[model samples]
Target: MVMVEVRQRLVVGISGASGVIYGIRALQRLSELGIETHLIMSRAAKITLAHETDLKVAAVEAMADVVYSPDDIGAAVSSGSFATMGLLVAPCSIRTLSEIATGVTSSLLPRAADVALKERRTVVLMVREAPLHAGHLKSMLAANDMGAIIAPPVPAFYTRPASVDDIVDHSVGRALDLFGLRIDIPRWRE
Candidate 1:
């Protein structure tokens, strides 16, 4: 008999941020890479999706292999034992970042990130806020100190992206690189 390895799993969190498209594109790319995705979306994230994208909440949910409610604190991903490659909170809102930084997770989204940090697994936060103040910078530094990568989705103009989707894909692809997933996207030449 032949044996096969289980597909790698990744936890994806979408918070209430302006760029929900980053989370959506992350799921799509992970699926293309044959990695299983477990998703947790906050209520604010659903509202933001409706306002920002043509995609419905149900459509976004369907992109994941499994979906957990943000309020479900007992979810599998909230436990460090639930093996996963890492947690990626694309377009992480300031509230979520604050929660994770302070270790006061009110929802499964930040809780999962905390678990990943405790397990020493990769936790990438595509923090999407702009005009940040000192508090935001402090929170980011705190999270980084706790082994979380604060990867704001800054566009790489050096890639000379032709469209908004290209920019998003490049950012998403680069974020996935932290997990050792090399996706096929334009790279900056040194």
Candidate 2:
């Protein structure tokens, strides 16, 4: 028998943040594009999902091609040889960023991110925090130094978004752009 890998893979980590929608939307878009997604969501992410939308945790998990628990330290994504495009932490929380920056991955989310960094794969962190202090900025710098891309989901006023979905979709699309995935989002025109 012969085995062949088909769709490209990307690890998606949904941390506890105000904009879990970014992670959710990323899953939706990736599914539509036939990209294999490996998902890991923190406990706080599940709680945030309940607060932010009507969807159940299982519903959100169902969006991904594969799912891992935060406590699943031995999950595939926790390894540097997993052969994924990389990890993407949509709506990355400050705490998660600190963990990844410090190389102290207590959960699978950051563990996978750290592994991706060590493997020189693209790790995109959609940081959702604002009013950052020196410490937060320092962590971001540290993560960047480690080769992780800190892409916060800031809206492009140039897009002239009409609804919150438009802004969220655009942000998620832009983050996926880091992986060389060209989503047909509104682009800046001259």
Candidate 3:
């Protein structure tokens, strides 16, 4: 009998940041890997998706195995009892970042992050703010201190990406590498 691997669960939270494509690509990649995904989209993220991309929110939500409402603060994700391998906040806005960093359990994202931290599970924050100010820096520091990985979606010219897709793939692959998943990509050599 062929043994099948039990897929791990990942919570993907999309904030109202500029790079909605990053979240989309991440969800696609996770699906391709056969990992079960739970998705949440902030109101601002919905607006950016409508304004910046041709894909509808429903279309994006269809990619995930489960989709949770952003305003549903009392959802299962907000509880630590929910078993999840990790949480990733793609295109994390400054507001969400600040809330998570300060231990403010205002919504699902921050609350889920808190659960991940207290449980010692992985929490990757792909913060998308630019032209950083002192406040942003401090919030990042706070999040870092609380065991969150601050993964900004900065471009890497070293990969010699030919298009936006390449860039997205590289970034998503790097994020996956954090969880020890091997995908097609060249490692950064010394």
CA-only RMSD, every prediction? 2.0, 1.5, 3.0
RMSD (Cα, Å) of model 1: 2.0
TM accuracy, model 1: 0.96
> For model 3, how big is the CA root-mean-square deviation?
3.0
lDDT tens readout by residue for model 3, 67-95:
98887888877888887888888889999
TM-score: model 2 vs. ground truth: 0.97
TM-score of each: 0.96, 0.97, 0.93
Each prediction's whole-model lDDT (CA): 0.95, 0.94, 0.87
- Give candidate 2's whole-model lDDT: 0.94
Per-residue error for 152 in candidate 2, Å, reads: 0.5
Residue 106 in model 3: lDDT: 72
> Which lDDT value does model 3 have at 134?
100
- Across 75-172, the per-residue lDDT of candidate 1 in tens digits comes to 99989888999999999999999999999988899899999999999999999998999999999999999999999999999899999999999999
